[model samples]
Target chain A: MTAFQPDCAVVITREDFSQDALQAEIFACGGSAGALATFVGLVRGAGPNGVIEAIEVESYPGMTESSIAAIFEEAAQRWSLLAVRVVHRVGRLEAGEQIVYVGVSSLHRREAFAACEFIMDYLKTRAPLWKKELGTGGAWWVEARDTDTEAAERWGL
Target chain B: MKIDVLFFARIREQLGVSRLTAQVEQDITLEQLQLCLAEQHASHWSEVLGGENVVRAVNQVVAENDQVLAEGDEVAFYPPVTGG
Candidate 1:
């Protein structure tokens, strides 16, 4: 067990996030944890039409932070975690740009991996954020997928 | 009672406005507010708010249509979230 970084668990911003910086902050806590897992979500270059241009990400200001906090709180309660971090970008992001980051630290690899995955699944479905894909054809709001809902539900949420 | 109603993403584009205040009877359920907006704005608002899966929130909390609303509460209606 080590010092857990729960205060920085949720970050919703318009600026791009640095994965290395986030990882550094997590490990800087000098925890006895043996494993750290991270996931980064990027905007794809391909779209339903042709090459994608950019995507506009939108979120509810007050609710977005609260939602992320609630999600990370659940993960911390579910596992013996050392640290958890989530950085989600909201604004106009070009294709291939980094969109999100989810990281978890724990004493064992299994909890680290499970908590990382769990945070991502819940973030996708619970966060009050939306995306609109822009491309040659036109811009359209990305619809919620059933697969994401199923992913979150699998955790008994 | 008056409450602030907000629209976001696709719903904001469809409505051509980000937010508006509505006056209604006290203790209106979330669903009633939607119907009232649809009734006031007619087809334009109806088509957008009438969707089966439109997400709603009260005072920044994800809420059901049955949730009771109070004066000065903030209500939001939008499409299902797609953030990663």
Candidate 2:
């Protein structure tokens, strides 16, 4: 890896996250990296209830930011990452709206892939954010699935 | 001792308040505090916070019920997180 981006590439905002900005930041931070990996999470239109109207995300503000930063620090320790950026949305979001983005850059494709997945996994279980689905019957807080905990466990965290 | 209690997501909806300044007896474990709140607030609060799935966090870190508490600690109760 040639150049590394700034350490804190994480973002937590209610505003619609700009993919272009994420790309630019990663590229600018990891100009020397040979590979860059990206993942974007979106709100699905269909849920167990009727079609979803929107998703409302809530987080403990100070904890949310600090926890994301702490996770990035862990990813850095585990892999030779050049740059990373994570953006998560909060508040009411329409179906198809982008909910999260995880971008990582590394010298090789494998490291980048591993780090991206690792961060996403940890973020799910470790991050202090919650989701509620709004639809016909009413709004229901999205329940955390054991599958997510299993995913996080796969990382041995 | 005094502490700050916070509720989020489903817990917030159930409790109908975002934050509360609470006074408690000394050396209470987090679980004991939950019981105290439930007795004070009644059904919905007990039903939500009492559930096994509702997670407790002490000072922003996910913690066990046995975690000890001190004055001025920030405690949060919320449903299991659902975010990517």
Candidate 3:
């Protein structure tokens, strides 16, 4: 008989992440996970500035990690998760670059899918990170979207 | 009491300072601290900090304006989060 040790990691970094590496981590966890779900957000090229050249992400160092960890904690409480990983990039990122990633693994497909979306919803509204879009025309801070708030609220958390 | 104050993103750029130390009275509410800072910096800061949607935190937890402050606490102000 073997023990099942759940794995969870939250990272806020300036460097890029490898989806294959992250997925491999989940696949290697305990060998009990039957499903894996992942989400990757990218820097878009279009905005109010017409054509965004890049985005500068800013975050409160300690709070950023803690807040995302809290979101993962909540997801764990609601779902049967075997593993979870979140990586969000800070500082300057060019268009089409990956900005964030959320991955979850569970005993079943449903749990993995739900936990991934749940973590992302909470992270969008609760994490202490902000984005500023820089374009050829000018630069502006990205505004909080009501749709995001609504999506998070739908979870009733 | 004294506390460290932090600002991020647009608010940091508007204020031209990322972090600062504030001298405050003992047992000041977060709201009171904000008002004190606004009073010291005047109109520009008042306008920036007074925005209805400005988010605040105490000791790294999202906090309401009425949250009490203590010495050595870290307080942060910034726009609502937009990350995924």
Candidate 4:
């Protein structure tokens, strides 16, 4: 394997997101003058129709990165995307904290938007992260949502 | 033989554990381990490993029945993942 791999897709976690880093990444991919779209997933204070106190995210250390990278590769093959980025946080996170980020750049706005949505759709359904909801009553693991599966199936993945 | 068992998602919450180390029987099959776990913790394990809906990954890769076991292998069990 190459020591320094150039990924059309990048995944990371910092104290917070950096606009400079994101912009640099877009330029690094030689994607200037193109439209860039992003989606920032936040930890919500509610679950499926209920109040949530906190949400815990968990993932297999070695497997999560590989899975996310694989999804990025598949999306690149499916869309006319120039660059993409995905970053997710683990451990105890409060509401409004950025849980995940997906960014896509393309020459056309349509492609940028489509690819960003595609990546998020795939990630929501396919990523190996697990979530637990803490609410007034107690804490429980959130069940897999059927709507998410349907959204992913719409993409034929 | 020693094997590392991992739990994720709802199963982890229900069990209140993320991982466990087990000394399973020699030449134990994956199915056997599942059954063993279910037997050990009859109440919760039965629900988590109930039937065919549960997902299993061996060594971080999705696995099926008949997957061979070895010492120091990692086996994980969880409900279907719904992440993005």
For this target, which candidate reaches the highest TM-score against the unseen true structure?
3
Candidate 2 regions with alpha-carbon error over 4 angstroms: A1-6
Model 4 misplaced stretches (Cα beyond 4 Å): A1-6, A9-14, A31-33, B25-28, B41-43
Among these predictions, the greatest lDDT belongs to: 3
lDDT (0-100) at residue A132 of candidate 3?
89
Candidate 3 Cα errors over 4 Å, as ranges: A1-5
Order of candidates by lDDT, top first? 3, 1, 2, 4
lDDT of 4 at A106: 75
lDDT of 1 by residue, B9-62 (tens): 999999998999999999989989999999988588988997878889999988
Candidates in order, TM-scores: namely 0.94, 0.92, 0.95, 0.83
Q: For each candidate, what is the lDDT? A: 0.88, 0.86, 0.89, 0.76
lDDT digits (tens) for residues A16-70 of candidate 1:
9889999998898666879999999999988666777999999999899998888
For candidate 2, what is the DockQ-based docking class? medium
Interface RMSD of each: 0.7, 1.0, 0.7, 1.5
Q: Write the residue-wise lDDT of candidate 2 on A14-109 in tens digits.
A: 998788888888888744688989999999988888889899999899888888888887787778788888999999999999999999988889
Query: Mind sharing the TM-score for model 3?
Result: 0.95
Q: For model 3 chain A, where is the 10-residue window of minimal lDDT?
A: A1-10
Per-model clash counts, in order, read 0, 0, 0, 3
| Tens-digit lDDT track of model 2 for B1-84 | 998999998789877999997789998999999989988886777788888778888998888999999999999988777888
Listed models, DockQ each: 0.88, 0.76, 0.88, 0.68
